[model samples]
Target: MFETELTRTLNIRHPIFQAPMAGGPTTPDLVAAVSNAGGIGNLGAGYLTPEQLRGAIQKIRELTDQPFGVNLFVPEQPEVSEQTEEAVAQMTEYLNKYRDKLGIVQNPSIKKFSESFEEQVQVLLEEKIPVFSFTFGIPSLDVIHAMQQQGTVVIGTATTVEEANHLEAAGVNAIVAQGCEAGGHRGTFLKSVSESLIGTMALVPQIVDHVSVPVIASGGIMDGRGLVASLALGAAAVQMGTAFLACPESGAHETYKQKILASNEDSTEITLAYSGKAARGIRTAFMNDMQQYPGEIPAYPIQNALTRDIRQAAAKANDSQYMSLWAGQGVRLANDQSAAAIVKQTIDQAYTLVQNRFR
Candidate 1:
């Protein structure tokens, strides 16, 4: 019975969204389950090709007739200026050490940095998906309008109040206020990642006040307490990534799941070592060692592509040290449950707690 602008706008039953987790964690089953459970499940399409993204959407449709979302990365091509060659050289030298350690003779250069964002958007429009979301930066007004004309509800991620303002002006149907504690890449383009650090408590209300669109609070939110707290701060819904990482439907490796259950509040840290963008994850030996070479690193798709082999090698060997264990600050609160079960539990617990306290 809990309804908010998010639910009303998206035509979903509850004000919960399974925040899209890119790389390997977000599966069609997980997305479908969330939508089927009355909350919106968003498939992370940032790392997928246009063909792959289309197939995934088709699979989601096969699995659920309910509302769901598909997310894409707003392409931000790094400015390769005078420091470009030096930075690439430094990054290569740094990766060479890992290549030697992992006993790989041939290190494949990053061929295709990222899938085409424009083509991806076209696929979303062709599919007529119920909702669409983008992170990293806001898409242009033309792109947003095209999708909207096709009846797509657009959502954009923002890390600071200024970014929220940009998204609002860009005409996103809603804004995801991604606090500093959020896992994955921080969606901040207006400022450097270091300067955009704002906690959920501070960021949400400011964004809620900054924009007229419905604000979905994200980052460090887990369970019913976080849900109720976000609503109190004027959020229409909560987008949780880490809370769903432990669910049975998640595609996260067994080792990654273990780390989530073992982590505490301070176990995670924000660093640019992984993808050359600030993202929160459980600190690993690799992250610790790469801390020194951060400035030399290239941005986004390039850095992400460069680290793919080593991460896969670590995963195959079950070496948690070298794997990118992306998570939020509330990892310890995670539990082993189905995605549907988690959604139902959060709805029941939050509604009961709110009624007990305010009604």
Candidate 2:
């Protein structure tokens, strides 16, 4: 077996982690399966309430006593101007069509935005979970210290070298070097998302050279080749999101799963139309329509809340045209398999590739 500080620290048989994919793709069963397969699994608790997060943690614990991680979305409060509201209003006609399909008479208003980070941290401390990961931004030093005091291994996600340095300075136990090719929301901290677009191959080695802590490479890593390349670049481990989306135990909707398997490398696009923040996903008609009326959309949670109902309806109808099919540029590399099978295959193959290189 390949040995590293990350593997020893996390007490895992392999240096692989199932990326915590938020917005329904990550399920407790999937997490447990990966953990049971001797890799670290993660729960994406970005959208869950404190109670819900606790419940999911309980379920994961019930399934396995192995070490796993929980990921949280660091809150960013973006100011909404009149122009943003007008931008969102432009989608009125498009959203109305979904109202009829979903049997809704009243237009849904924006729900209040809140991140239960403080409360959720308390839950983690109380539960004494092994690892706590954060995305979108890093938490304050005090918060990190608090979690560290409770023996939680803190990990921060970064889309750039500057963000990785910031995370190291803030005392993160390790850094997840999230590249531009990663799926879901970009976790840029220092610069605008546009300026921070570095691909995995270019970003991983640089962060590994610069950061003091262990670097966990994340992005378009899909198979054994990707894993071997990451290790060669000095990564202590690799975290994969899109690679696991096609797993049978994933919580992704049927339409989302089908679309993932059918997608080519060029099928995904980085668009803010769905959540008012940049995320990579398969191109859809709703995305195209939103582009025609771009400037009016509200920021993040507001825009995210505004379109919740339409997205729900679209999922129920198995309509890919309107759903947020988040994926990485390596969508074409995904395989349809059970989570346990995928984990075992990746670990075994990666080990073989690493051995061949040394020989």
Candidate 3:
């Protein structure tokens, strides 16, 4: 029953792909466990350095022989502008208070925003990852071609149908239709975010209808019913984040796991204060207080880099209020299970539901 195009093409038993919850959540154990359970597992390699990304991929390779994937955040080239200057000044000032609170004796300049994406791509091609997916923006055709030549399946994220068209034209093997309700960074690059805020149900079918490449549904999908519904909406598979956040194998903080387990649908929100991008996460004091500084916020990677210190320290101190609690809208439906169990249950229930409907 799981022998759909996605499963066959990716050589996985089920079409359920674990969302590569970038940062602390996607541990080696979590990725391996999901793949071991006959679904696609992913490493959130967006923030890792080339060495770190290679090391993490090696760790996943060591843990499982099953097919797994890696996701990278296509680095946004920092541009100089008035908005950038004002936002940086405001952000630096706002971050200073937290630095003082965290007791770092001296103000360390935030790390430079430029990242070696080419270095990371070299690693992916060298490692020969079965599936390599990128978010934030699309990779060049040459980069995509090189990976494809090595039999690597390249996937790109798309928040709008235009982005989907661009990705398909760029030769991505698949597109992740990231709905507005998805947790973590919104993969909107072309249009104003307001124009890209389409829901999963609405977004998936439109992309499926418009593009020839297979479409993977993401955002707000938590359980079997969501899976079946997504497939009904023409998705080849469902990529889930919040539901996997609570899994035992995840590397998310204990507090993060607790919050996800205890959350309700309305408990999460979209805020630009955390990463300078409009990401959906658990509402915190930091998010609320910083909401007024939208104009002062720098573009992504920069904003993402600025908040790294506070989020790390907050996690260490068990201070949930200041942490980047990225989550989807279906967080309330999360369960305390192992990643393997979650995969088995989601696929099993969804398969049964499809079978019953046909029968």
Candidate 4:
């Protein structure tokens, strides 16, 4: 039988979840489209303000009545030292070039990190949102209990078996086994990003074996074969990021979508240049610049803030080289279709594979 709790809790027809991709790609239209297609779609609210988060949720509600999830980036207070300032200064040169192009004299100063987890949690609680997912780190015990008390289904992301175990201990209802081939940020928990880089084939089953909660396999899972492999490895469901990235409903810029369609398995790489945290994406000029200036990058939210203007300008100009272009190793599998069509096609193909195997 299909996994009962996951299906019942999420109210989804298929065991597929459209991963909550942060930065700019996961939009309300995308979330609504997937949910309408009988899969759980997610809003990546990590970078939005509390009001913006609420607005997006309301927008999704306007489109579909299906249950959906919101993903948050749990923030950690970093100790900013002189080294951090120097790193921020190092980005000035890059910022200056963008400023000149935009016809501004100086780069905009770093704005205070606007996302307040506490405030956003209150909003979710007030709205009685059905599902909540988190990456970057796990929420505190009190926060977890609070969300659970509101009857929200909680899912935590993990890049390794250790991270999976930790999420189980933290009382998450499910674990997203985010293999190295996944796009976006590497949710490595307390470990260094480099140390936890396990590929999908090797990581999913180990996490499934280690965690008491149900595992939702993510990363490099773009099609029927990938989905079947995840289920065989003990996953209750599968989450795909890059695969849905090319959908018309996704907020990914045209250039970003084109890059994914053009890429092969070897086109992406893990780099900390984008957000000061290691994430896999296509190699570009910005990535090259970061490589040339290793160890000079500021901490996240800081580096993320420093580059916001440049990234925005790049998106406006459709400049792939300067944009983040966040994606996974399964970029080649990204099909340019509507979100619902992609979901139906993937689920149908996977179901056929599963049935044929038994026959």
Candidate 5:
């Protein structure tokens, strides 16, 4: 009922993709389950070291022979100089409050803020992943070309039409049009995050109009209804994260899953408190308290690294207040079913919808 060029090209049965929810949710089991169910499963490899990334790919391959994707964070090299030390110090002191609450050390030593993108890309190239996608910004032409040469279908994230255009020019096979309602980090590279906060309904078709590649609609899309709507909006497929977040196969913290089930549409807000970069998640004490901080938050991996210990401590203590519970506005639609069940239900419901309405 929902076959499209994407499904044909990717050799999948359904036009659905399990969004790559980095930071543990996209477990090998989860990715394999979705791929086995005939949708492309994506491994969020952004946080993994090269060894870990290679291991994960091998694990997913063992579980499913179907095509799957691996996603990476396009490295952001924020200036690290004397000029930024003051802001870093101010933010560190402010975050220390959470450390105290979590009963961790007052201050922690962080040797490195992020993994090596070059090394990670080398891993992907070595693996010859079926699909390679990235966010934050475009990778170098050499990297993209190398992946394509290896027969990997490449995809890029875009928040605006301009970003979509840029991705197409860079030779991505498809572009994920990420709207404001999306969870996790904002994939805004070409413009200010504020300037790029377009809704999915408004953003998808615009990007589809501007780009020659397939447009994959993301953000707030939760069910069969969203899938049908995206197809109507000229999207070749739908990439859903929140819908699969609480599934049994997902590796999201139990407390985070509880919040997803309990929270409603108004529960989430965009906050830089957790990750430095803007990302949508269910609000908590940390998010609210950080809003009053006078100092500018350190950019990206800096803030993400500084808060890592606190988040880990909070998780160990079974506290959701400090963990980064990334979920889109479709929080109300999330469930704790199995990954295969979610895929089947979505396809079944979409089929019924198409029969009843589109016919």
Candidate 6:
């Protein structure tokens, strides 16, 4: 019953998108399950290597023939100034305390910080994936055009109307209107994080008015209620992350899934501790301690690499305090059902709402 430009353009039965959550939660099984259920499932390939990305794409293809998307992080060359070096040193020393507690070695030798983004993009081109999406910043026009040439729908993430305008001018197929209530990293590339903190209700319609392309509303959206409200506000579709974190297909740690089911709306907070970028997650002891640190936090990928060992070790120990439990404010509504059930329930509820309430 719910069909819009996004559904028609993407060739999907529903206008729902499973937000491309990076790390472990967005597994190929999860992605394919959503597509099989009529929603577009997205693989968050930002941290994946070229070989790993190819393997994942193959895995997804094996599971379902439906269209799916792969999301990448636009690379940022953080200026390595003397101050940045100092901050890295300070943060490294501070994070050592957590290592000691987790019973892991301190100050492990670090060589590589991030995966090769260019090689990752090349895989997408060669594979001719159905859709390509990115966050943090826009890709070059050449890259965008290349994706279009291959008939792959390209989507960009935006936190403000101005960002949406910039993306439209750059010739994107669609723009995801990421709101302040979104979980994980903030995709505010145009303005300071504090300035781009617009809620979904306010951000979606303004972006829809500014840009001619379809706008996908993200952040804090959980159920059929959010889906109908976003459509009412001029959104062509809705993207959800936290809503799927607790799904059985999700690769999130067992402890993390439990936390999502047990937490509430007030349990999450945005912090720069886990990765230098500001992202929302359920508040933990690590985040609280980092808040009191007198030194500046290193830039993303740097800070992300520095704390990798700690997060991994905590996972092995089944300790939730140090893991990056990325989740949105809609934690109270998260379910522990299968991915197909979640998608079906959402569409059914949306249909009921439209039938009984709208008409």
lDDT of the candidates, in the order given: 0.89, 0.87, 0.88, 0.85, 0.93, 0.94
**Global CA lDDT of candidate 5, please?**
0.93
Q: List where candidate 2 sits over 4 angstroms from the true fold.
A: 78-94, 97-103
Q: Which portions of model 3 miss their true places by more than 4 Å? A: 79-86
Give the 10-residue window scoring lowest on summed lDDT in candidate 3.
105-114
Q: List, residue by residue over 38-61, the lDDT tens digit for candidate 5.
A: 999999999999999999999999
For every model shown, the clashing-pair count is 0, 2, 0, 0, 0, 0
> Regarding lDDT, does 1 or 5 come out ahead?
5
Q: List the residue pairs that clash in candidate 5.
A: none
Give a tens-digit lDDT track for model 3, residues 64-131: 99999999888765644665876777777767887787765334576566457899999999999999
- Cα lDDT tens digits, model 2, 26-84, are 89999999999988899999888889889999999999999999999888855456766
Top-lDDT candidate index: 6
Q: Cα-based RMSD of the predictions, in order?
A: 1.5, 1.9, 1.6, 1.7, 0.9, 0.9
Residue-level lDDT of model 4, residues 250-320, one tens digit each, is: 99899999999999989899887877778889999888876877456776777777778788888888889
Estimated TM-score for each candidate = 0.96, 0.95, 0.96, 0.95, 0.99, 0.98
Question: In angstroms, how far off is 66's CA in candidate 1?
Answer: 0.5
Per-residue C-alpha lDDT of model 6 across residues 1-359, encoded as one tens digit per residue: 88899999999999999999999899999999999999999999999999999999999999999999999999875545676777777888888999999999988867778888889999999999999999999999999999999999999999999999999999999999999999999998988899999999999999999999999999999999999999999999999999999999999999999999999999999999998899999999999998898977888888898899999999999999999999999999999999999999999999999999978
Score residue 53 of candidate 4 by CA lDDT.
86
Question: Candidate 4: minimum summed lDDT over ten consecutive residues — where?
Answer: 105-114
Model 2 scores a C-alpha lDDT of 0.87
Model 4's TM-score against the true structure: 0.95
Model 6 off-target regions past 4 Å?
79-83
> Which of candidates 2 and 6 reaches a greater TM-score?
6
- The lDDT ranking, best first, is 6, 5, 1, 3, 2, 4
